[model samples]
Target: MSVLPLVFTSGWASGINAYAVVLLLGVFGATGLSDDVPEVLQRPDVLIAAAVLFLCEAVADKIPYVDSVWDSVHTVIRPIAGAVVAALLAGQSGSLPELAAGAVGGTTALMSHFVKAGTRMAVNTSPEPFSNIAVSTAEDLGVAAIIIFALFHPVAAAVIAGTLLALGLAAVVFLAQRIRRFWRRRAQRRAERRPTGPGVRHPVPTDGSEHF
Candidate 1:
């Protein structure tokens, strides 16, 4: 169950499958399944599941406030996965097509990261767990939708890929400011919590002259 979610979140042909499998094995060594096979090869169901999961993740990232945290976490993961998957898919296309795919893939990754990060940052202002959960779920759904549409209609996917990139960037600028504000407030609070130097320096008063 948990493995499925992890794989789905990782994305199709993203190389994450290989890394994730190995990581799982290193941690759960030979417990039930070997960790070398590609996710798609190992489980056809994973393809569909990935599509569904991505769709949800994507939608979740688009949510108003909670999208911020989701974005922060995905920042490192989405683009690389997008590029790898695009590279893999490009193999099936012509040179020109492949280049286009790669571009789309890389862009998709960048866009996804921005949108997720920005939205989450904005959401940080509220930091409501319920809102966060809702946004997270929506992004997962969005990822799935992207996968499905991209698989069925590459051209449409390309267009959407561009749109997503734009939107993600927009979100970055929008949420960055908000996140900064949140951080500033948090820092101020921390500073306030700190103890001021020595608690009331003892009056060296009478003994001051002798100490000197």
Candidate 2:
């Protein structure tokens, strides 16, 4: 079976939540649930590490500003993970070069990562935490579900993943201006709230132009 679909799906998932994708692939591969998953990923140590990181991400992803920080930190991690997973999948077939697969994975992951990070940054502008929790949960569930589905129906899963990636990218582009404006407004609010120095005082107009 061509590993192209799995490669795309894994790349997309990794961008959103690399640890969750790793954990799912490891668990499924270890249990004989997925033939496409690579053996290295199914190692007990790998699974354990992925599970721990997934847990940490789950917690950090539900907090507003913290999630953005987490995303920023993972900017490098996620793309690397995507490339590794793609290379592993390609290795299973021995038909595609690891380099080619890694390039595909890295490019896809970078695109999706940008969309994810931008969306989260925009979301963080909101004061409420519920949206963050909801979005985080949705991403986790989406990664888990897509990886599982790809095990049985790689083409279908890949199509869905592609569609999602396109939509997400479109959304990020459409909202770019709004996101920028949101940050500008936030900065303005912060400036307004900042306390002035104790000695600072407004000068009185002696010309008697009415002080509003």
Candidate 3:
């Protein structure tokens, strides 16, 4: 079976939740359900570490501004994790070149990361915490479902991931454009409200003699 699909799927998931992808892949490898997963990822220590981090993320991701801060910190971590996982999967399966896999994985992860981060920032605008919790829960469940399904049907999973990624990027662009327009209008209003510049003369009342 070709590993490219799994690579792309995992890369997309990793952008949202790296630890969950690692933990799920580790379990799949340890259970002997998938032979494409790297041996190192299946080790007991690695699994344990992934589990702990996953739990941490699961909690932090539910908070409003905290989630945004967490996203900021993981900006670098997610793409790296995606690249490493893709390289390992390719190297183990020998179905794709390691460098090529890494490049694809890293680029995909970075794009998806922007989607997740931008969405979170937008969601953070809501004063209620429920929205944040709901969004975070959905993301976690999404990652789990995609990774699990990828193991059984990689091609379909990749197609789904790619479509979702495209939609997400579109949403981000729309939001950004809206925000830019808002700020531009606000600046224009401020400029209009300003007092007239120096040297501009006001109408003078004439009483016998008006000063020129």
**1 versus 2: better lDDT goes to:** 2
User: What lDDT tens digits, residue by residue, belong to model 1 across residues 73-112?
Assistant: 5566666655554544444332335455556555545655
TM per prediction:
0.54, 0.87, 0.83
Report the candidate with higher lDDT, 2 versus 3. Answer: 3
Clashing pairs in 2: none
Model 1 residue runs over 4 Å out of place are 1-74, 94-104, 189-212
Cα deviation in Å at residue 187, candidate 1?
2.8
Q: How far in Å is the alpha carbon of 117 misplaced in model 3?
A: 0.2
- lDDT tens per residue, model 2, 124-177: 778899999999999999989998999899899999999999999999998898
Q: Write one digit per residue (lDDT tens) for candidate 3, span 1-212.
A: 78999999999999999999999999999999987789999999999999999999999999876887798899999999999999999999998999999988888898999899888877766669998899999999999999999989999999999999999999988788544553465478677987797997666776757766
Clashes of each: 36, 0, 0
